[model samples]
Target: MSRAQEHPAPDPAELGLTSDCGSCFGLCCVALPFAASSDFAVDKEAGRPCRNLQDDFRCGIHADLRQRGFSGCTVFDCFGAGQKVSQVTFGGQDWRRAPGTAREMFEAFPVMRQLHELLWYLAEALALPDARPVHAGLRGALDATERLTRGTAQELAALDMPAHRGEVNALLLRTSELVRAEVPGKKKDRRGADLFGARLKGAALRGANLRGACLIAADLQGADLRSADLIGADLRDADLRGADLTGSIFLTQSQLNAAKGDAATRLPAALSRPAHW
Candidate 1:
């Protein structure tokens, strides 16, 4: 697995991991950098707003981002970082209006994003009945991360979130082990497999250790993925129309955004299917 895939994006609702662009200052459009790849049409430097960003902090072509060569935008989520930076850190100040604070705002956005993502995972870990043994530690981490997320701009920009994540990640690993113990099979060690575009319809993958597997564009229709270790697995464009993903670990909305699913797709409680699905 690539180093970038080691961390992924977040119970969105109760955990505040869901994106709320309406209340945001278009931080994602400005704070993130993207090159002209298959995912993006144009090269945009960090702290520079995308040309598609509207004056109202909305995307001018929100409905047709992919059609406009901005597929990356569709799959991106700020994990509530944009709104937090806009409302809490800057007190509703926007970069365009207050150019003085733009640099700090841009710098702190990604840091806040990481903290928020950790909070989302910690919240999920605490919710796992099988992971109750670590609930106290998870709750402590959640509270600490929450406090960090509410820090001042300088504090956030200087935050060492990776240190905090390492601590939280250890707890999550314990949580995963406890939950996977109930999968009722000898766990498969398929970690880092390059299963790209492989046909695996109706496969018995329950409790499989598929961590960091490159299942990109693979046909997984009607597959039984219950209790699979999907942490860092790339599900981009993978067909999961009727696949059962209940109890899958570390699956993210970004991964779901890049895939196709339907009513027959059973998901864990923390995840919801994309509307386009």
Candidate 2:
């Protein structure tokens, strides 16, 4: 039996890594900046609320985000950072009501997002039975990252993000190696390859190390992507119809959202099928 079968998959909701927009204070709408591109219809600066952000902190164009030329908003996932900052970091304070806290809250949102992203990856790593050798270290990193997320706004602002991310990245890389090692025979090492718009339909990419690969608009229709390490890979507009990603590691909802997939595409258990597919 494969190492992944050694243990049952953990509940992704238990990790608190999924976005809950209702609990958020529209932090992503205000904290993040977007330029006028194919993704965004208008340019929005940081710390400024999007025009579509309603008074109740919900997106006015949520249902029609893609049709309204705000497809960028549809693909963006804060990994539950919005609710964490709104409810925990600021203690349920709404930036609209507590205008004084707006600046700091905006600053803390992105920082918390990064930390929470690390927590998400670390949690997934712990679920991998093949990565059992580093499970203890992964737990420590997860705990540390969660603690960082709970820090004060000032603490988050003063954080050295590069250093912290680097430390966590090292552990994640080790976990990836341990888990991906289970794949027999030769494995593809296409880490960071720029395959933008490459026509690779029906590719035999099982157990491929595609970390950080630029696969923007690549034709991956019906590809076998099981057991691949897709952490940080740019999958924007990549066709994934009928592709199998059953055991892919480090693939996030944001990546899936950015890609093109149909019902026939097999995703990991934790991820959902993107509505845009």
Candidate 3:
């Protein structure tokens, strides 16, 4: 990891981790590939623009994506990588205006997305009072990752993403341990478990480690998930109705957007309730 000078930690709110499509150049619509799954209506190869994308780089069915068989688009979050690439990395020169750079730009989008995602997690870790012991490490990782986001397209496309992600994941895991330890009793260790269609409604999963768990379509209604580590958990179609996720760590908006929830589902202060829920 790159060493950064000691400074105040980056505020998660100020990092622009949320997607701003208006400032973007339809990168997600063009750079990403989607299959004819329940999430997408049709297949689209990488570097190909979605049919719904407009000349002005706006989604033609943005407000009605879920109703239009493009439910996957609603859950996809670039973590502000789109605008960062369009405006900063590429200096606001869009792919249409500079076709020569389009391929490199497309390749760099995913890489930048990963870096931004790590920044989001690190920033969240820094805010946890129980994770104070590892705040220094978290801040350093956040700084390093943010710097990586500003690299040229060539540098980003050639980055060793897995190695960097592993390093940041270690720090996040340590932070999770510190925070979850505050919860009494033996916490569940369900990391990377395959819990597809699980009937875990009302399960007591407080302080549980659920990192990278495949929870697709699981019946998780009314589950108590306070203080649980949910980094990288696939929650697509998972039932979150009446679930209390009040202090859940690493739960992103995109994850919630993918799940089935209701007005009764409690969330952390950092996340908002999805409209479709």
Among these predictions, the greatest lDDT belongs to 3
Clashes of each: 0, 0, 0
**Model 1 off-target regions past 4 Å?**
1-15
* Poorest 10 consecutive residues by lDDT, candidate 2: 3-12
- Tell me the TM-score of model 1: 0.89
Using lDDT as the yardstick, the better of models 1 and 2 is 2
Writing each residue's lDDT as its tens digit, candidate 2 over 190-264 gives 999999999889998989999999999999999999999999999999999999999999999999999999999
Model 2 misplacement above 4 A:
1-11
Could you tell me how far off, in angstroms, the CA of residue 233 lies in candidate 3 after the best superposition?
Answer: 0.6
Cα distance off (Å), candidate 2, residue 230? 0.3
Would you list the C-alpha lDDT of every candidate in the order shown? 0.84, 0.90, 0.93
lDDT of 3 at 226: 95
Error of 3 at 111 (Å): 0.2
**lDDT tens string, model 1, 139-226?**
7888889888889999987777778778988898888888889878687778899999989889889988787899999999999999
Query: Which of candidates 1 and 2 is the stronger one according to TM-score?
Result: 2
Comparing candidate 2 with candidate 3, which one achieves the higher TM-score?
Answer: 3
Residue-level lDDT for 49 in candidate 1: 89
